[model samples]
Target: MFMNLLRENKIVAGILTILRLYLGYAWFTAGLGKIQSGAFNASGFLGNAVANPVKGPDGSVVYAWYVKFLESFAIPNVDIFNFIVPWGETLVGLGLMLGCLTTAAAFFGLVMNFSFFLAGTVSHIPTDLFLGFIILAAGYNAGRIGLDRWVVPFIRKTVLKGKEPAKQHA
Candidate 1:
């Protein structure tokens, strides 16, 4: 029922626009700061996350697999993360802000939010995740007042050009 309102209601879409803009601004600023720092490194953070993994109530590692992944793949490939994090955030911000690909933007934003949560850095993750899910659920309507209003239809027409069912003679 709530999802239906988010996806189909014009009034709700207007509200979502506000949330989208807010999330987009947050993402843009974070990425911009990292890009400008000229010393943004993920290795240190990844190492720390692995060292102090999220723990369960019993004091056992809650995400042992994630810790291992960070120690193995993430640390070894820190350079990739250094590049992807900033750039991906910036692109997601732009997409959401412009409402060009709002759903994709929200989706990626949620991914980062979850990654941060898994790394045991909650902060704004809960709120961001909540809003992102809302935007994602809203789908095309989320961007109905923005670029997706036209971009979606254009892409659909172009991609589906020859894939339509053939008409039969009466």
Candidate 2:
């Protein structure tokens, strides 16, 4: 019921647009700051996550695999992270804010939010995740009031231009 409303209702799209704008602004500012500073690095954050991984009640590492991943992959390739983080965030923000590819934007936002949570950085993540989920779940309706009104159809036509529906085997 609620899901249908979120995915189909224009009224709900308006509400979702507000959430999208707010979340988009947050991402854009954060990313733009990093890009502008020209000093943004992922090594420190990734190193810290490795040093202090999430632990269980028994003092055992809850996500040991994630710790290993950070240590072996993320930290080792911090340069890649440094390059991608800011650009990725900024692109995601632009997409969401302009509603160009809203669902895709929300998907990436959730990915980053979860990555942060996994790394134990818990500032504004919960709220971002909550709202991001709503926007993602709402699908196209979330961007019904924005550029998606035209962009989506254009993309669909361009991509599926020659594609035909499958024939039914009677």
Candidate 3:
């Protein structure tokens, strides 16, 4: 059954691969810029900026709902978070480009986009596109033409074979 589904979904896998490549390059370029400009520390407007509203669990912000949400979890100096964000983007971009762990890469891309979207920076459209890309990666069979195809099948055959029905139907 699963093999039939995989056989029928070649086009979907291709499209997902293309989407992965495009988003991967986009994310890689963005992260590259941050690395070049030394902005990964997040001293810029978005990262360094403090979340306003200063809510006290009452869900009320003087400015915007988004601000309140930010105040709750968007504290700055997040040095560890800052350090990982850009590198994570870069690695995810590479993974997408190479079609290795493509689904996981897309998942991280979606998360990064969600974080940006929550910033209310008017780039939600692309973020939405990224989210869609993640869904596509999860739904389609991208492993056939990618590393996942080789690795996952081996794992399934070796590890999951025990769970499959016997040749004699038991």
Candidate 4:
């Protein structure tokens, strides 16, 4: 029911536009800061996350597998992280802000949010994750007020081979 409203209601779409802009601004600033900081590096951050994976009440790592994966893959490839983290955030922010490929942008945003959560950093992630899910749930309506309004239809018509309805003879 709520999802229907989000997907079909213009009022809800307007509200979503506000949410999208807010999240986009947040991401843009964060990424821009990181890019501007010549000394920015993910090595220390990734190492800390691996060293202190979120612990359960019993003091065991809640996401042991994730921790191991980070150790094996992420930690060893800090250089790649150095490039991906900042630029990815920037691109995601731009996509969300422009309402272009909104679902994909929101999806990636949620992925980053979850990654941060799993890394035991609980800042604005919980709120961001919830909002990101809402944006994703809204689907096409989420981008209705922005570029997706045109881009989605273009893709459907050109790439997906959507056909126009036939006109009746008068």
lDDT of 3 by residue, 137-164 (tens): 3542654567877766666589898364
Backbone atom clashes (below 3 Å) for every candidate? 0, 0, 1, 0
lDDT of 4 by residue, 51-163 (tens): 87899899988999989989999999889988888888998888889899999999999998898888999988999999999999898898999999999999879987997
* lDDT agreement with native, every candidate: 0.88, 0.90, 0.61, 0.89
Provide TM-scores for the models.
0.92, 0.93, 0.66, 0.93
Could you tell me the lDDT of residue 165 within candidate 1?
41
Candidate 2 lDDT by residue in tens digits, 9-35:
988889989989999999999999999
Candidate 4 lDDT: 0.89
Which ranking of candidates, highest TM-score first? 2, 4, 1, 3
- Report how far off residue 107 is in candidate 2 (Å): 0.4
What is the total number of backbone clashes in candidate 2?
0
Which parts of model 3 have CA positions greater than 4 angstroms off? Answer: 1-8, 46-73, 127-131, 134-140, 154-170
lDDT by residue (1-170, candidate 1, tens digit) is 67677777999888888888999999988998999997889988898899899998999999998888888899999999999999889988988889988999999999988888999998988999998998998898899888999988887789776354454343
RMSD of each: 4.7, 3.4, 6.3, 5.1
Q: What's the lDDT for residue 29 in model 4?
A: 82
Candidates, ranked, lDDT: 2, 4, 1, 3
